[model samples]
Target: MNILKTTALVALMGSIAIPAMAEQRVLKLFTDASDPAPKAAFEQLVKGFEAENPDVKVEVNTFDHEGYKTAIRNFLTADSPDLANWYAGNRMAPFVNAGQFTDVSDVWEENGLKDSLGSALKSMTIDGKQWGVPYTYYQWGIYYNKDVYKKAGVEVPKTWDEFISNCKKFQEMGVDCLTTGTKALWPAAGIFDYLDLRTNGYDFHMKLTSGEIPWTDDRVKAVFAEWKKVLPYTTKNVAAIDWQDAVSNIVQGKAANYVMGNFAVATFKDGGMTNDTLGFMDFPTINPDIPRAEEAPTDTIHIPAGAKNKADAKKFLAYVAKADVQTKMNEELGQLPINKNSSVGDDPYLQAGFKILSTADGGIAQFFDRDAPAQMAKAGMEGFQEFMAYPDHLDAILERLEKVRQRVYKN
Candidate 1:
């Protein structure tokens, strides 16, 4: 009788423990943060979230950055994860419109993100509702050679006219004043983005990219006319060489400035340029009357509409949204955090980026390629490249782009 009682007690304990273990919720996370730094950053977030919610087991599915772009379209419709990583600005619009992503505005309001992540609030929002939480971003500006400026005997330019005038000095010395390789086509769009933002401001620029304004509008012509002023001083072989080749020109002092993202700082350093030699600054102001805006491409995270564990996924979003969490994550990724209260690392370039982006009251713009639809971004950039090579063809290029604009945004 005693042996039978002990056996029954052991069986009862097994049944009790199994149900308790089964109570733990599993949250699926799909991400393109497969690169070492980004992967580690997500791991930090996951670990942090798990620490706070011990009953939630996070299951992560990592994908290559490029491949995930295509994979997400299928997964979001078929087998959606509880959460996924995506880009900010117009890049996320398609998923949002298709009802693949959940509206997380409540999360933003409840967590007080309106104050802490104000800089990124505009980008992460669509139709007056927040869709995701932004975590990391990097600045885009004129990465110039200080040594080249000294060599040209000209001061750093503060206004668009001054920059154009300085280009003449660089031309006189037979050096390219502004060098960017457009073999990949996208680099030319950066120049156009700064030109439009400076000439027209952020709202107008966003309208232009969204196909609300005709590509051949008078304002568009004005932007190209500004481009003409410095055309004589840019790299002659811009259409033939890639961006990396132009980096060599900047490093060799064969070129003066390259309008590029902060990531190029690493390549510039690898090419034997130091912080002293490689100077970073905001893109020279084109219209002093217009408030200054800055370009800072941001990466974000969101909950899928079909998420099975919406509760736990929201908890993850709120966790990553914290200032301390972002500060640590961005530090690991060597990028700037989007949180207003987050502290940047010791890198001078990152620090400068933080200052300029934080102070950009005019607006924060994602890159041209990001703010436009994929097809439109491709066609628009192609037009930008052709315009750089043949300024006389501006009328033709604008008309072609206007047609693409109508077709792309007809919906």
Candidate 2:
């Protein structure tokens, strides 16, 4: 009987100890960094975070870029993760207003992030409170094929007139001057945003996007007029293709230039184009009187208000906000780190982007879709896509978009 009692006690102790051993402090992270490089960088970050905090386990759930856009809305409200990757600016505003995202001001103060994040802090802040921390951002500009430019004997344009002239020259050489994919719609909005920023200035662009200004306003019309000048030079049937397909045209030398964010540089490199063969230039000066503002969309990470592990999520946020962490992750991402002290390395494209954005006197706009409400942004980008395919429908497009703006903003 004594031997049997001892055996039973040992079995009970084993069962109890196993549950204790398996109970780890889990930090659930949902990320949309599906690209190989960014996915790897995130994994590396999680590894480091786990190593530093041995008692905590981080469970990361990654989704494809497009799918995550839809999935985040569902998961954020239903089964909230400890952290999730998202965009700053207006894209984050809804979540902030809904009280879905946690206010990470404490993390910022604890880590002295204001000094580290610099200008990027503006995009992450909503109503005097910081919603999230931006880790990386890249500039949008004209990316051209040097070989194609050489074939056409046209130099990079510096002014608006020069840009138009160069497009004419490329046409004369029997080469398409510009190419873009509007199938996803957002690419067209990017072009519209740049033109608006160049022609009407950043403040006006913000007002227009935020529904403070009507889409049918003359300032908005002027932006479309400027865009019209370049449409003739763009690839035909752009609505049928996506951004990657348009990028292939530039890579294959079917087109001379593309207006895109710096992230597209990776696509170019993968298409077998060398850095020396590709050239990066700022979007030419349209309104030289307007101080140069840039479309520098920042990607951010946030702790959800419904997070099960707020303390651990804050720890991860603080870890990511560090300069060293930003540097490493951006090195993997091949993009500019938001931390002012982080190195951008020897990538010429990144260096140029860094210089342009860091020196932008007029500040930055977080791309059209990011800076505008989702409902309005969707209709606006679709209108842009329609306008690209049928410029004559500009008025109709603007009217339709204006209706969406009114409904969405209740203006």
Candidate 3:
């Protein structure tokens, strides 16, 4: 009888320990940081998280930036990860609407993230509920060739008339006034977003993206009209080349400027262009009456609705939301940390971007594709590219885009 009792006790103890062990099992993470710097930063973040939670193991599955975009839609529904990386704003809207992303507002409230994250919180929130925590974001502006600008004797133009005049002068100096690649489509959308933001203001831009305003409206057409005035100075055959190829025109001194995000700095450096040769400037003012809104697309992380380990996923989100983690990760990736308390380091370009975004009284735009629905973004970018390639067809493009907008938001 004594032997049998002892064996029963041992079995009970084993059963109790198994449950405890299983509680600390793997937390799968799906990420898209194919670039070396961002990938390294992500690895360090995971390493830190693992060290902090010794009981939990993080299984990271990384994909190339482009491949991950398509792969995420499938995985989020079929084999969901405990955590995933994605953009804020309209980019997150589809997943939120589909109920694939967890409502992380509780996490934000519990962790005091609302105060810590500041304005960035607004980008991740939908229907008055927060969806994710933003890790990093960068500013968009006119990155110009300093040498080309100096040779043309043109200072950074701050008004519409001066901007057009400077473009003419640059063309007279035997260089195209601007170089942009619309082959990828989104670059052209960036230009359009800025024009709309500067012309009508942030409220109008947001409404337009949300399908509250028609693409063929007079306000939107006015934006395209302004854009047409600058098109004469942009590179010829823009639709035939990708953004990187277009950057070559600026690097080789064949073009004066490129309106792009801060992420392009690394590519310029790799092409033998340095900060001394390359300069950053805000897009020239179109309407002095309209407040100056900056384009600052934010990237975020979230827990999937089907996450197997909500407890552990919350822990990971909390870990990354801290200012220290944001600072370290963005520093490694050469991007600005979204946390207001985080340091931008001594990099001048980063400092400039941070200053431009943080001080924008007019507020921030999450960029065109990010601020609009996925289907609307797709049709909008195509229309933007078409308008840039053939400005004469502006009315036709707007009408077609209006049809897409109507269909996409048809409730």
Q: Which one wins on TM-score?
A: 1
lDDT of each: 0.91, 0.88, 0.88
lDDT of candidate 1 over 1-411, digit per residue (tens)? 999999999999999999999999999999998889999999998998899998999999999989999999999999999999998878888899999999999899999998888878777888999999999999999999999899889998888899989898888888899999999998998899999999999878888887899998999999999999888889896999999999999999898989999999989999999988999888888888897888889999999999999988888999999999999999889999888888997788999998888777677789998999889999999999988889999999999999999999999
Better of 2 and 3 by TM-score: 3
Tens-place lDDT digits, model 3, residues 1-411: 999999999999999999998877799999998789989999999999999998999999999999999999999989899999998877888899999999989889998987777657667778989998989889999899999988998898887678889999988888998889988899998898888988998879988998999988999999998999889998998989999998899999999889899889889888889979999988888888887777899889999999999889998998898889999999888888877777888878899887776666676779988889878999999988888878989889989999998999997
TM-score of each: 0.94, 0.82, 0.85
Displacement of residue 64 (Cα, Å) in model 1 is 2.2
Q: Which stretches of candidate 3 lie over 4 Å from their true place?
A: 1-26, 63-67, 288-291, 361-364, 373-375
What is the Cα-based TM-score of model 1? Answer: 0.94
Of the two candidates 1 and 3, the one with more favorable lDDT, higher being better, is: 1
lDDT of candidate 1 at residue 150, scale 0 to 100: 95
What are the runs in model 2 whose C-alpha is more than 4 Å off? 1-26, 33-36, 54-71, 74-79, 151-153, 240-245, 252-254, 266-272, 289-291, 361-363, 373-375
CA displacement after TM-score superposition, residue 365 of candidate 2 (Å): 3.5
Q: For candidate 3, what is the lDDT?
A: 0.88
Two-way TM-score contest, 1 vs 2, winner: 1
